[model samples]
Target: MWTDVTLKQILLITDGCSNVGTDPVYVAQTAREQGVTVSVIGILDDGALGEQGQREAENIAQAGGGMCRIVRTIDLSHTMQMVTQRTMQLTLQQVVNKELRQIMGEDSDALPPDVRTKVARMVESGTEEVDLQVALVVDVSASMTSKMPSVREAIRDLEFGLLARGGTHRLVVVTYPGPSGEDAQVLRFEGTSVADAVGALRAAGNTPTGPALFLAVRALRDLGESPATSSVRANPEDREEGRMRHYVV
Candidate 1:
């Protein structure tokens, strides 16, 4: 039920700061380099997240080329939907702009008003028609136990809304701090249905968001979702210091 032109993403739903493992920001950047966008939603119903937690969420999204937000249990459903849709639109725009640059040497914004308007319409339509493959990296740490109900509801809501789009969607579920002492565990590796996985979710172990993200990327790769990594001339804007990926293959 999927298509060839699919957008791959990792949507991380967490409640607090990572207490162990690798740095999430670095992992997020690596994911972006590998053709996956990583978005984060910090749950605030339990208590306010610390500054470090807030910063990490923001940094991860920026590094991974996705979106980030902090929301309460009641607002999670809306936030999740917003983040996923907004990220998909943004990614599609970047792709469209990249193509425009190759053809006209200018981005959409630099085009004549009429031309820009047409390009915008195409991007909008593409956003609604393009397929999606999302790996939901959920936080199963003990602290998140009380929020599982809301989490489950949000997942269902997200799936319902996305499936209503013209394009097909494939969803995978992965939870961090595996019950058996691992960094992350894959409850649902295939797609769309997460009920079984949600029932299997257990609240235990310390948070390990970084390692969990790494595993999520690996899982997506295992499923052959990420685009093939090949060498290409770096875009001019991407030539800035710390942004270059010359001859990447």
Candidate 2:
């Protein structure tokens, strides 16, 4: 069984549109139903993706309840970092709104916009010290071959960006169509950089993104059960004093 965690996301980076079995949007919707967010980054370089591809990217994100953005290869790293931070911010906002509804009455939706913003800011500041686990699911289909270099640089930049935020995080890299066709391979680097693994990916085979996402979710669930992550509580309680503070960001 999969363990419930504070945040579980599948960041899909692809260049071409899906041409496989199940629709990617449906897969993304299933992920959301299972408490996982799926964000898509469509890489557009030299006019690789057309109108249909862009629409598919947007539709997938909408179905998954996450953000989608299209960017050139040169901007991949910056966009990747932005997407991660944006997802965290949006999640924080949702947590704050839920807490507000619980603290205030159900009819307290009458609060002014500025007041709500202030409260959200307070909540974000309070939860800045929390840790995060991100699953990066990259599409290594044949079409994305030319964008591999940019993808590698992006992952490296994302790591530095996360570090600058002063939060502890574990980033697991999952690539689709591993040596064998349509297989999702989970790669981990000990005493080495994940960017290397990403850069080494060879683009081949079909884009079985639906199955890849299923694999990513499973990986995240397994990560949640690890001994290191097991000790961290999303909503911690003061056992001695019988007080509790619910924090989810």
lDDT to native, each model: 0.79, 0.72
**Whole-model lDDT, model 2:** 0.72
- TM-score per candidate, chains pooled: 0.84, 0.82
- Tens-digit per-residue lDDT, 1-249, candidate 2: 002225667788877777776777898898889877889999888644688888988998999888999998888888898898788777656665666677674321467786655555444543344456778888888878878888888998887765654335667888877767656789767555789888778889877777777788788788777743222333432341121132221
Supply every candidate's count of residue pairs whose N, Cα or C atoms clash at under 3 angstroms.
Answer: 0, 0
Model 2 TM-score relative to the real fold = 0.82
Off by over 4 Å in 2: 1-5, 105-110, 228-249
Position 18, candidate 2: lDDT: 70
lDDT of 1 by residue, 1-249 (tens): 112467889999998898899999999999999999999998877643678888889999999999989988899999989999899988877887787788678887898897777666666665666677788899988888888888888888887877677666667778988888888887753344475458657888889999999988988887674453222322322222122112110
Clashing pairs in 2: none
Our tally of clashes for model 2 stands at 0
Residue 84 shift from truth in candidate 1, angstroms: 0.7
